[model samples]
Target chain A: MTRIITVALIILFIITAGCALFVPMQKPVEQDNRLFLWLPGASSVQVLSDWNDWGGSVAAGGIIDPLSGRMEKDDTGLWTIDIAGLPGGVYRYAFYVNGYKWIKDPLNPETALFDGRTVSIIMFTN
Target chain B: MSTSLITLIILIAGGTDSTDVSIIPENWVFGYDCLIDASACGDWINNHPVIDSTSVDAAVSVSAVSPEVNFLVTGAMRNDSTSHVVLRRARGVVKWPGTPWIAAGVYLNDQQPFIAGLSNPVLEWGWVDIDSTKGFGVSSGGVLGFSGDYLIQLTSGDTLSQLNVHSPWMGFAGVDYSRARIHPADSEGVDITVNVLSVRGDFRYFKPWLIVAGAEGEEGKWAVSAELRELRPIDTQWGRIEIVPGMHFAGDNIDLPGSAFVPGQRIITLGAFLESRRYFVSAGIKGMLDLSSDSLSSVSASAGMISEGGITWDVIFGYYADGDYRAYVSSTVSDSYASAGIAVEIIDDSTRVTGSASYSPRDDVCAEVSFSGDIDDSLQPECVLAVTTSLGPVMCLVGIEWEYDSSPSLRMNLTGLFK
Candidate 1:
């Protein structure tokens, strides 16, 4: 048992360090009780923000901004979308790119894998 | 009587009821004939008979039913140049047993898609033609429908008839069964079945037996059914998959030679699949382990894809491995093949045209064209025309097909309560 655990830990450590070098995690930004996300290298990114109604579009098409929102573009292919004026309630979001595929938010652990292989995020706020 | 004889008797009695039965020739009784009461106008439930029909083949069976439930069934197989035909009829399901079973089932014929054998209050006809030529001697078969208790019989050529009772106890009893019988081309032989297994519920409705189990609602789901079959001289096959816990198994008979399955090789398959509406995707593996002898083992995976409309397709690929305890032949025997096809619905109404092409690299490629039309208002009988030809060595089966459904055998007779 000890040997198995030791081997697992070593494997985990190696993967984490390798990811740090190849796929760095994104950092989100917060201001005025709102969260700002940015993704630099993405060809296209659509955001489902906290303020807009679920049916209508909050923002239709938006390109990634690298410098602001305390955002950094890592080697991995992920973008952070700035979520502003997010209320005290829970917030959910997703990204649609190239008109046909979905990718998970690397920074949000609450994101779930859709039944059909897509990704979505849910947030709980105080 | 021997055990086989007793089994045969019980099977015959299980599918019949009191009704009007008629035999073309009078004073002729090839099988058991029971007259229940006055209403049963021509109730002649014919059973086993000699096989010597050069032109037509028929079988009539009756099942026991209570006063509230009435049912009867009959089927036939015939052949001609214009097309081989299979006629079926669901005569009727009257308020009582002694009532004729004929009024309920739609009379079926090879000429067109229309309901026959019903009058007084005409009904609209509806029917879908599947593979009419594949049933009963690879050319055509016959069937009749009724509401309640019933028996099934098959007769070919002249003077040859065989009776079989499938599900004696309707849906009330959780136990059910299916019997695939074949009467040899010659009447001198005894009738036999390729597979017979108890169903978890009453999944009997003449077509698509699998759908019956699922249609009974939650009660039928999650139920397990066991079956034992002897598939040899019949050239019939069956397969299944268990995919829940994440392992798969599959096996089939490709008409291989030898005593490999003298006692019959057992094929236990386990596999599962995931599907959606517009698009359906499933992946499962099948494993064929040596049951009779450790001569061969096989594992395979099958995947299928279909669109919401337009065309639907399926693909299967697998490989086989030789068993370790082989007594003769080579050290390894494995092969992989794939099949795919598309179907298009050309006409929308009661009549439609469909075409498909399929190929297996290991086997021969084939293409098929078919048309199904219903000329009548009743759904029981339909007309189908089809031609299938091979894309290999020589075009096989460039022939055409046409079939019909017969009216159900329903007649009013003995009015009573068995209980």
Candidate 2:
């Protein structure tokens, strides 16, 4: 009985060590044509871009369309939106949060000056 | 040689002192005189040495006598009116050729303070190699009304025995024993630990914490530890929840200072991680409660995300039972090419903002600048430049810092190991 228990223990150790050391780790894959955006601690978020007629409105030389440029928020207070299948071009965009506050994307570093204010920019290619 | 001739030779060889005499091994005449001196060996043993033996059976003995009262004389002479006189006796023993080799010693000082009306004494004993794996030792010394102390321990393999039987004012007292074991299955494992303690004037308690994880054929990774007073379980693949109920002993599982356990608090935590080809996100919530009641004590929530193309961010919100709320957000872009963070407290209307940027101008040098302060005040940044270089077996680092309110400082450090 002791020998059988010892043999079983040896086999178990071998399997555990193999799994801990040899298991393959997953790596993130880059999606060149897709843009993932996130904004934390925001009640709501929307993307205002130069494309799609700036979501169909122009107020005081700025885009103010709240109807078609909405972003979704998850339970963790993170607002995220994904834009896919865009043609090759340079686009300017900003975020509208809580139906009133308009701000630049804090995660995106590329920015351009527009109408005496700084706006975020995204360059996409097919 | 003739006796007259030997006597003359001895006088000529400066043998004026009777203690100076030599005996020849083969000369029967000198051997006869040597035996005569051996009979008075005690008188001359202090200044003269003599040994005469041809086999192990031959033996010699010596003795000395001195006055019982002696003074501790030093270079500086002083009166001995109030000086302390001491009388001490000590003995020790050692044994071998068994599983355990025992050694012990005892010392008594008649002039020392008394314990239980007896002369103060100290006892110490120890046994090692008890069974190829065990050993025990103890020491104690004390004055009944003033000071006392003792320590006793026994150790073997993963088990420990501690006997806290003596203390200065409390006399003798407690016993604590604990042991740990681990059993590993194919893809899972179990760990168990038991602690038992009893004190003469205090409560007796027993605590056992058991943890089991990863049973055979189990999916994902899961672990659970339960004690008679508390329980915690974690499951990672689907989601993770850790609930700790009742008061927890501080250093029982993790190291903590002060009391053995923290009382009157319970914690429940929930968290999950989800990852895909392009993005990874995680969220967690921690709730604390008053163990004596059902009232909510405090709550905190945190979430984070990382996406392709070097973007990451995290945020935390805390609501304390004292009606205070705090929120913090931090984000990084381009693998920390630029990073920014903000913190706000609702009760005091205080906010802090911080940012930093890093640039690598050359392969061996990098420059970075960071700024942080209250949001209502102007930002004052600190800039640093660092360079690293290496030579055979030696590495060197040089850095320069410039802060808004301080002079520029240059620092250099070198480290190496020799073969």
**Candidate with the greatest TM-score versus the true structure:** 2
Per-candidate interface DockQ score: 0.01, 0.02
- The C-alpha stretches of model 2 lying farther than 4 A from their native spots are A1-126, B1-260, B263-279, B292-296, B335-348, B361-365, B377-411, B415-419
The local distance difference test score of each candidate is 0.28, 0.36
After superposing candidate 1 on the true structure, give the runs of residues whose Cα lies further than 4 Å from its correct spot.
A1-126, B1-154, B157-173, B178-187, B191-197, B201-263, B276-279, B294-296, B306-315, B322-419
Tens digit per residue, CA lDDT, model 1, B1-419: 12443354455554343245632223222232211112221212253222232232222223323333334332323333543322233232333234332222222221111111101000011111211211111111122222222222233321211122233333332222222333555768544332222232222221111111111112211212122111112121222222322111112321111111222334343334332212222234445555545454555444432222212233334455552221111011111121222222222233222332222232222222233344346533333222222221112222223334432222221111111
Give the candidate number with the greatest DockQ.
Answer: 2
Could you tell me how far off, in angstroms, the CA of residue B248 lies in candidate 1 after the best superposition?
14
Proportion of true inter-chain contacts also present in candidate 1: 0.00
lDDT of 2 by residue, A1-126 (tens): 999999999999988755543332222334433334443333335677655435433311122333345666444334556677553234667775433335665434334443344456564322
Fnat values, candidates in order: 0.00, 0.03
